[model samples]
Target chain A: MTSAPALVPRPLARARPLVEPALREAVDRLHPWLARIVGYSFGWCAADGSPSATPGGKGIRCALALLAAEAAGGAARDAVPAAVAVELVHGFSLVHDDIMDGDELRRSRPTVWKAYGTGPAVLAGDAMLTVAMATAARTGSRAALGELVGALDWLVRGQAEDLAFESRAFTGPDAVTVEEYLAMASGKTGALLGCAAAMGAALAGARGEAVTAYRDFGRHLGVAFQAIDDVLSVFGDPHRTGKPAGGDLTSGKKTLPVLEALAASTPASSRLARLLLERPLAEGQLTEAALLIDRAGGRRRTEAWAHIHHQRALHALHSAAPLPCPKADLTEVAAHLLHRTA
Target chain B: MTSAPALVPRPLARARPLVEPALREAVDRLHPWLARIVGYSFGWCAADGSPSATPGGKGIRCALALLAAEAAGGAARDAVPAAVAVELVHGFSLVHDDIMDGDELRRSRPTVWKAYGTGPAVLAGDAMLTVAMATAARTGSRAALGELVGALDWLVRGQAEDLAFESRAFTGPDAVTVEEYLAMASGKTGALLGCAAAMGAALAGARGEAVTAYRDFGRHLGVAFQAIDDVLSVFGDPHRTGKPAGGDLTSGKKTLPVLEALAASTPASSRLARLLLERPLAEGQLTEAALLIDRAGGRRRTEAWAHIHHQRALHALHSAAPLPCPKADLTEVAAHLLHRTA
Candidate 1:
């Protein structure tokens, strides 16, 4: 097949210039040392404080916030605080999640805990979260601030469950079920994105069903995005993603694909479950496990779930009845998020 | 001097019944595991999840919030959310502080990170903070939420500076100065107390100068409380405090007493500086350092500073011109805070 066009959403570039400066200013309120750590986390600088060539994560949440505000009949610039708050929260969660997961790398760079000590990394995460709240409060919008805090509550709860899953049995009643897995993903990956959209709408003076629609839109999109991530982590090219293939499998992460595969209960699925129960996968076993998972229809089932959620997200957006230009912008961004290789 | 009357303030009893229920409700929103860890930190339960008999801290900050509201012509019950928010923030800070300081013990029991793991403790702290913001937002007062967020920012900044001090030289240009130490204490301890008072008043609809007065009152009182705590940590009777005397000294904490003594630059202070530079303080070195600090007028200077701040706090309270009954209650609490033995 011919190569598809690139999936860069125009809204991201549009949002970056507005959100980046505000994000930096919020982080600047932290102590100089903490600011340095957070800056590194944002890919603004290297570990030693020099400017970095590597770019930060796509400001997808920021773009969503800006577009949501615009769609709700407010200027995108008016929602800059919402964009900054969500971005700070996103960075904070990543930093803490890395420490919790004991993952030492992100985007091919050392994780905050690996580069700085765990204690400093902990402080850095705390600083970012505090900055997020302070930035959100600056908007003088209680609804926006409430949305941010609610997302935080869900985020931490989700993280706690995700960690607990690591110790759970791979099979039987005590094992993590698919429903439990989806709930965890909704909190872990979805809540902040939901907040990003909801806060933007709220800041724009949108209330009632419209805000809910935007929240649902972002939440469903987040789940879809996470589902895609699970597939790419095991099956995509390492060169494209800048991460090792099957690393999640070797690390024993309870991704949607693996959970779905185990639920299938076919011969391959049974073997896959038993294989995962081993404390550490032996060399080349990761590839074998991936193959078994794929054979058991894990990849296809996961993709189907992604597609379902992706469609639900679009439906939510359509129900929101946003301004035409920003609605189209949001649709383009959502499609890109679903299709991105990295 | 003859023994003085006990320093228990009646406002604590009044505040507890109202604040505790709200605080528990907020904490209940966390994941079960996180709630358990946080419960242990709050002295509400043991490591094994059984209820604990040990009474928690006096909830001074909570009482402050309640009294501030009453003093500002609002019912104390009206500020329970503010009271609960400050208490949660206080507990959150302690959990994270224990991990950051690597202190294994608190109130003669294992710290949260010591009983649970560090990662869980980190999540517990985050849970409490999220609950705090949520609780504060439930007040539906933007000013109150803003105050709480501002205090969190200060709390984290102070903690970062306190950790940075551990690696700084004990003397010369690189040493932590008295001003820096006070500033850190203000952020670390004063900010939350200030927020408690300010938020209560704000929620009470007391604007402008009354809120500022309450904030300054609590801030000065908190600094004074910290000064006294620094002195007590070194010299207080272990039986009464339920902690080892001179633990702070052995830990090489850059508290007010030590900072004052070092600033004196006397021969004893110079000797104290050299003795501290040795890693893993030798046996009896703690008592020696305490004595050297005392001989250099550190103890007196610290006490004098505390007295000054205490007086300033009372003056600010008087300037606020709150209602007569609550003002009297606040004065009683302030006196207890300044003079408490433990």
Candidate 2:
């Protein structure tokens, strides 16, 4: 079990100071009301427009962008705009996703749509997306812009699929397959991470095969990250994850572990499947479901899946042939992300 | 009064055949459910994904793009991507705007959100915007991409302002002013039109001054077009406009006519102000409000504003030094747009 202090990798620490100022400046370009709503999303302010105590996201994507730039033989500062743009896009997705999922909490506070009205939250999400495109365009790299837009398209498709999957039966021919889950996970999470790495490399004047390899590395890494998050959501401490234990099960989200559990034909797995369909599950039922998933080997299978992707990510990173120091930093960051408790 | 037949300007008729196929192709790349929702937005399908009899938007922006390209010494076909991209963006805005304004109808059909659910409509709008950005980026012109992004930002800002204005008092100092309405109108409408024309020229290999002049022409034309729309929402025949008469007043939209009416200090205007504060106005009250606005000179003033922008548009078009045939076609199109009854 890694200590909380160890979660902040040196690369993330280095990248945060460089990226936060640029992110703030870009957000300030939005309409005042929109800026306020978006600011809350970033943990910069409370719902009342006062400073907040809660810290924002981990800045993993920003660090990845800057590190990719350095690995591609450009200074980290060259990818500041790319970093800000990716963060904005990520924030935009969370704001809208909460509305779509009707989730009321995020980052230990009310979601954007919960704090503001749905209409204003929708507008804030749109404003963030608009600013992201504008910020990316300012980089003046056609290839980078193309990558960002491509990722955005995939991200939207991924979200649409995720929402569509919720109503699907837990067991049947209509059930979501593990393969389908992987594809959705790639599009929803991997695409933007891939774009962040690709944009960083492209902005650093890296071309062709090297950039492709970097993108591949990031995509695989993103899948691993999501898998870890899926595990933590059900099994980790609620205080650390900032979500109730087994929240995803109660919400009926089709995460990898649940899908894996259903694939298992054991009695425990069958009982787990039945429990999930009777959603708004009691806390005790949620506990039973989690235990059933573990009993059916779903937890181990999901962990193995994450490890497989981690290996693939490392292979792609080696192919990218990054600069020695940045390569080492990226490795450390990757490890932290994959092994973090929250 | 210009008839419906004359409203289909020659350029628009020509551009539609080229643009629609490409537009359909771009939309086909979306998730199946999203494509269906977006197709509904284009009047190409019904809520159940069946074909529909309703006609789509006029493709006015598409025509402006194609014509601007030809004017810049490139073939109109050279700007097909630009035309398609701008129309995608226009459709995107309409889908989202309907949600924000809580309007249930557009183009004589149920609005996207009204037909589908709000969540699906939001996803569909996002998909269209993503496709638009990808299409513009495919043109491989950084300047054109910049123009498109700038317009999107302005469009978002304009919408935020318009939404914020709805809660403001109609008579107090917080009342939306004429100047504020014009600025919002330019952002809400002019920015995209300007982007359409500018992107067309940029893609046609036109440089600095020519592209700027074309953009200016489209921006002013957009303001004129919106001014006409404001008047029609108040006074146009329901059968022709495909909306209830005085619908904007009933919805409490702060359009140019309403702002002008509020600015006036006449007896009719004072009563109209009082009437407006009681929203969800009755049918008879709406009719009386329209009459009061007309008696207070709002209709005449709004028409004058439209004419003023019309002159400004033509002046900018002349300065663009378009080829003779394209110049004549654009001038005719401008006249039809400014003078159409519905």
For candidate 2 chain B, the 10 contiguous residues with the lowest summed lDDT are B1-10
Q: Tell me the interface RMSD of every candidate, in Å.
A: 1.0, 0.9
Candidate 2 per-residue C-alpha lDDT over A127-167 given as tens digits, one digit per residue, 9 for 90 to 100: 88889888888888887888899899889989988989988
How much lDDT does each candidate structure score?
A: 0.87, 0.87
Q: Write the per-residue lDDT of candidate 1 for residues A1-342, one digit (tens) a residue.
A: 123248566788778888898888878777999999999999999999898867898899999999999999999987899999999899989988888778887888889999998889889999998888888877888788888988998899889999899888778989899889888988999998899999999999897799999999999999998998998888888777767677788889899999999999899999998888784787688888989999999999988888888899999999999999999999988888777778
Candidate 1 stretches greater than 4 Å from native: A1-7, B1-4
What's the C-alpha lDDT at position B146 in model 2? 82
Error of 1 at A338 (Å): 1.4
Once fitted onto the true fold, the runs of candidate 2 whose alpha carbons sit more than 4 angstroms away are A1-5, B1-7
Extract clashing residue pairs from model 2.
Answer: none
RMSD of each: 1.8, 1.7
Query: What TM-score quantifies how close candidate 1 is to the native fold?
Result: 0.97
TM-score of chain B of each: 0.96, 0.97
TM-score of 2: 0.97
